[model samples]
Target: MTRRDMILAAFVATLWGVNFVVIDWGMSGIPPLLFVAIRFVLVAALVVVVPRPAASWRTIVGVGLFMSLGQFGLLYTSMALGLQPGLAALLLQAQAVFTVVIAAGVLRERPTTAQLVGVVIATAGLGIVAAGRGGDAPVLAVCLALAAALSWAVGNVISRRAGTVSGRGPLGALSLTVWSALVVPVPALALAVVVDGPEAIATGLAAFGWRPLLSTLYTAVLCTVVGYAIFNGLLARNRSAAVVPWVLLAPVVAMISAALLLGQIPTPAEAIGGVILVVGVLVTSVRRRGRSEFSLRVSRSASRSRVSAPVAETARAAD
Candidate 1:
């Protein structure tokens, strides 16, 4: 990747990492479901200005269902139910594991040995977090977060499959993100009516303030629109392996931002578990032999060939 691309990747990661804090603040006054609906509505409106990609309606809706609605719905509810922002950020990375497993089953993409081992380690970290759960982090919230991750993983597969079927690279990530987002507002509003009640929705909307509005705009414009645009552009130009690893920095950024902004310091046990979880992710996702390693191997092989040439010629002359 070029230095510019690397900077863009880092910027996206930062935006995404700080997103949890924004969500927490945004949902503070508004009902979670209602807030989500409004956010997606804005996203759909702003981004749908772009011409639609050649993707099918099914593909757009499927990505929207799981990625936008399911993931955000569960995640928002999880936070409202008492999941801390920092921990929520960390736990959401479980999507990586879920994606690998789902791809193995649904897409027939087998997990590498490194990925399997990373899952084991990550599972161990989750076990630690589960054992240590107590006052602040409720079991239900954790479960909901895990469900969100699962939803996200399912969306990943849907998007990948849709891309395959369309014979295009997932109809451009930005297009999928925007078009799929069109699927969110109706169901989310309906769900808000059912769960939060029509009165609560009306009240929340009436009482919406600048903080939540600004939060919504940041998430919709910066996090969703700009972030995904850069990410998709990178994916188009580069390998998935290269682009995907940069996302690992997101949780770190989230944790720090949560600590400074929200005063959400993880418990000692949670911290230890989080470190283990991150390590497991790195182990699972990072390539064993990257470009530098390949270059080194090539150089070594050339050197060996050069050294042996003279010896081989001497032996032939002697014979």
Candidate 2:
């Protein structure tokens, strides 16, 4: 990557990392599902100018269901249920491990030894996090975050299949992001109505101010759009091995941003668990020697197509 691209990658990572704090602030007065609906509605509007990809609606909607609806819905709810923003950011990285395990079962892809080890280490870290609940984190909140990660992993598999079925290596990132996002608002709004009730939703919307509005726009534009655009550009110009590792910086950024911006300090147990989880992810995603360039090419392609929050960790190379 060029110096300019390197800066762009880091900038995007910062945007994504700070996104957790933004979401927490944004959803403070708003219902979680309603806030998500509004966020995606804005995302859809912003990306309307981009030409739609040639992929089928089924493909688009499938990605939306898992990636946008399932992932964000659960994530926002988890944070609302008292998961700290910094810890939430770290826990979401478990998506990489979840993706590998899911692919092993559903796609019949065999896990590498490194991936298996990473999974075990990550699981132990998660167990520690779970044990710290009620004091460090809420048990329900942690469980919901794990479910969000699993939902993101499911989206990754659906996206990979869509790419294969379309005979395209992967759909264009912008197109996939926009079209899939269109599938989110309706169901999200419906659920919001059911869960938050019409009066509460109306009251929240009426009370919405600049803080939440800016937060929504920042997430929709910077974190989702600009972040993916820069990331896809990096992949287009360089090898995945060169570009993807930069994403490891996101958790660090998230933790620091949370501490500074939200005054969120992780407990000692949560901190130790977070380090183990990040190390496990690094182990799982590290490029092995003797792997073919063709495999790298596939990883680059997958990186471009997969849609998640910039902070949403992917397990493409592991697959």
Candidate 3:
């Protein structure tokens, strides 16, 4: 990757990391679900100008359902219920583990030994967090953040499957992000109505002021539109191995920012578990890259040396 892309990746990670603080500040006096509706309303409006992705509507809507609606709805609600910004950022990355497990079951993509080990390690970290949450981080709030991670993982699979519906990995990822957003607003608003009621909704709308407006603009424009655009572009230009690790910086940024700005610091258990969780994600991602590289080498050898199909299959099995 070029220096420019590296800078851009860090920039995106910073924005995403700081987003928890932004959300906490912005949602004051507003219903969490309603905030989701309002934010997605701006995001969905981009469909008027941006072209639709190459994926089918079902794929798009499925991505929207889990990625946008389910993930953010639970996330915002969890924060409102008092999960700290840094911890929420850390816990949400459980999606990395969830994504691997779900893909193994639903897509029949068996994980490598390294990945399985990583999953166990990450789960151990989660157990630690659960046991040590204490009073500051409510159990229900932690569960909701975890549920958000699970939802995000499901969405990740759906988006990945869409890329392969025609047997490809590369995709019109930014377009899909924009188009799928069309599925978020109405459902979020309806959920807000159900959860918060008409009076709260009315009050939330009335409470919409500078902070919320700034939050909407930053999230919709910088985080969703520009951030995804740069990220997808980087993936298109670079190896997934090179691109993915930069994401590790996000939780670090979140934790540091929360500590400095919000006066929120992780408890010892939370810190230890967060570190383990990050290590697990790093191991999984690195092994995945190794697998891809090995596959590439095998494919090249088979093409050059006329490797027999059975020999190739046996080698793959051994791998």
Candidate 4:
């Protein structure tokens, strides 16, 4: 990936990391499913003025289903079920591993060895984070978070493929983000009704406070609109392998923010694991300088081979 896009990805990760804190802070009394539906309703509202992306509705629907609805729906539910915010952030990163593996099998986009190793190392760091910050999270909650990760990976592939189609430029990333959201609100609301029950939804609406509204605004504008817009563009421009690893930075940001802002200090093991995650991302994102140099050498050798046979023969005789 180019340095510019790499920086963009890191910035997005930072915003998202901070977003976890915001979501945790605000979602006090709201039912999780209703909250998910509310946020996406805000997002889907963008379709009124925003230009539609140059993609089929099928692609748009797929992205919306997996990326927006499926991922966040599962994620918010997991937290509602008692997963810690910090652990939830780390668990969601399983998408990076799932993304690379799935892209390799389905999209034929093989990850480099460095990427595979980096993903493994980062995953190990997540395990350490879990150990360092032990909690009695429910098993079902953990499973839901992992399922959210898988949903996010599927969404990444869909968006990547959509971008590769002709006419779907980086500009279309914003469009896709907005347009795909159209498919989210209804299904998400329906799920909310089914899961949260009608009375809970009414109570949540009745007690809806400024905090949730602010959280919705932050998520709708920064995390979803700005963050995913740039993320989708980066994935379009670079390989999935190159793009996904930077997400490892997010947990580091999340833990640090939690410590500073929320007074939830990390154990030494957690700090060490955060450092390891950063190292893994760096390894995965190393420039392909060696491959470029090797190509140059091959070209030089080919040039020498293209020299006239008689001239080479005479030169050899002289030597």
Candidate 5:
């Protein structure tokens, strides 16, 4: 990656990492679903004025459904139900394993041994987090977060299936954002009405102080819009193998942000497991890149030799 890309990736990571703090803050005054609804509304408004890519209504609509509606709906619900912010950040990275599974099973792609190992390690990390959290905390919320991870995995596949765009990454993102912002609010608003009640929601709105409001803005503009834009741009520049490792950095960023912002100290188990998880992801990504490079070299060499032999045969026949 270029220095610029590296910088952009870091910015994306920081934005995503800090989003846990934002979510926690915003959930204070606004109902989770309603908060999500507000975020999406702003995203829709911002992207509509931008140069978005042209795509079939089907692809655009499908991606927006999985990414915008499904992912955030489950995630916001999870947070509201008492999933800790730092840990929530870490668990969501399980999307990698979900993506790999979908790629192999649905897309008929082969999995590398390292990828297989990553799946195991990530599963282990998830197990640790699940094991660590015990209480009157709603188990449903934790399950919802897992659902969100699965939703995100499906979204990744949709983007892949959507294929390449001709300088339409930003435009495509905008279209997806608008579609997502529009389609998702219905369910979110509905859920918020049922749970928070009209009066409660009104009270929350009346009570909406600057902190929650600003935090909501940050979640919408920085984390969703800017962060996703950078991530997709990186994917456009490099293969998924190169681009996906940055996700591993998210949990670390989350842990740090949580420490600084919420003063939530990590347990020894979390700290140790986090290191292992990161190392495992790094190992898998590096080994996969090496194998890909080797395969490309072999394919190129074989093509060259095949072309050279046909020319040599033609020259000998002429002679």
Candidate 6:
């Protein structure tokens, strides 16, 4: 990647990482689903006002269904149920492994040996995180968080299938956000009505001050709009394999934010687990690179052998 692309990726990672903190902040004031729905509404409005190229409304809504509705609906429910923002951010990286698995199965893209190992190591790390949840989290909250991860994986697969249809620039995410506003809000509101009720929504709206709203706006504008725009644009320019490693950096930013802002003091096991996860990601990436080099070498050698075989046969015949 170019220096500019690297820098932009860093910026995107940091913004997305810290978004956990914003989600936590907003959760205090507003119900998670309501907050998310409102954020998407604002995002949709922003897209409508800014104006962009033509895209099939169908394609736009499809992207939105997965990215916004599927992903955030699960995410908000998870956070509301008591999953820590920091941990939620960390676990979501599981999407990378899930994507690898999905690609191999659905796209018929084989994973490198290194990636397979990375998958195992990351899986172990997740097991550790899950085991830790027994005491630290509510049973239902853990389930909700896992649900969020699954939803995100589903969305990733859908995005892989969708491939950027012409005219749906990054602003196309707004189309998804609009659909999110329409599709997700109903369920979120329904849940709120059931769990908290109409009065609860009314109270949330009335008591809702600017602080949580602003945080939601930041999530919609900076994290969703700018971050997705930059990352997706880079994905368009480069391979997903090349672009995804940059996201591993996101956990680092999430850890730092959690420690500094939330005053989360990690236990020794958690710290060790974090290191293991990082190392696993690096190991997987290196393994893939080595395999790529070996494949290229084999391909060239085969080509040379094919070219030389006929020459040798011709020479033998001449003799």
In order, what lDDT does every prediction score? 0.73, 0.71, 0.75, 0.83, 0.69, 0.63
Lowest lDDT sum, 10 consecutive residues, model 1, at 310-319
Clashes of each: 0, 0, 0, 0, 2, 1
After superposing candidate 6 on the true structure, give the runs of residues whose Cα lies further than 4 Å from its correct spot: 1-7, 49-58, 164-187, 238-242, 284-319
Q: What is the C-alpha RMSD of each candidate to the true structure, in Å?
A: 8.7, 7.7, 5.2, 7.5, 6.5, 7.7
lDDT of 5 by residue, 150-248 (tens): 887887666655546612456565455555456666777888899879987788778778887798789888887777766765655544443454576
| Clash list (residue pairs), candidate 1 | none
Cα lDDT of model 1 by residue, 10-111, tens digit: 788789889999999878868898988888898898554665756799888888899789998999999999888877876786776676677667866555
Please, what are the lDDT tens digits per residue for candidate 4 over residues 30-131? 998888889988888988888988888899999999999999999999988887676778889989999998888888876767777888888888778767
Best by lDDT: 4
lDDT of predicted model 1: 0.73
lDDT against true structure, model 6 = 0.63
Estimate the lDDT of model 5: 0.69
Q: What C-alpha lDDT, on a 0 to 100 scale, does residue 300 get in candidate 6?
A: 63
Q: Is candidate 1 or 2 superior in lDDT?
A: 1
Model 3, 1-319: lDDT tens digits are 5567678877887888888888888889999999998888888897887778877999889988998899999999999998888888877877766777777678665666666766667667766765676767888898999999889888766765665332122236678778888899999999999999999999999999999999888888787777765665555444333444455456667877888888887778767876776676556444243444456678678869999888776554333
Per-residue lDDT over 163-247 for candidate 2, one digit per residue giving the tens place of the 0 to 100 score: 4433232237667777788999999999989988999999889979999999999988887666655655454444433444345
Candidate 1, position 6, lDDT? 66
Residue 79 Cα positional deviation in candidate 6, in Å, after optimal superposition: 1.7
Query: TM-score per candidate, in order?
Result: 0.79, 0.77, 0.80, 0.89, 0.82, 0.78
Give the runs in model 5 whose Cα sits over 4 Å from its true position.
Answer: 1-10, 134-137, 166-171, 236-242, 287-319
Candidate 6, 1-319: lDDT as tens digits? 4556667777887998898888888768577777777777766665456554344555455556666766777777777878777677767777766667766677565656666676667667655655564377666766666666666665555554454542154555334434333445565567667767777788789867878877888888898767766765555433344445456557657767888999975555555666666666565545233335434555567577775766544433211
- lDDT-best of 1 and 5: 1
TM-score of 6: 0.78
Name the lDDT value of residue 96 in candidate 3. Answer: 62
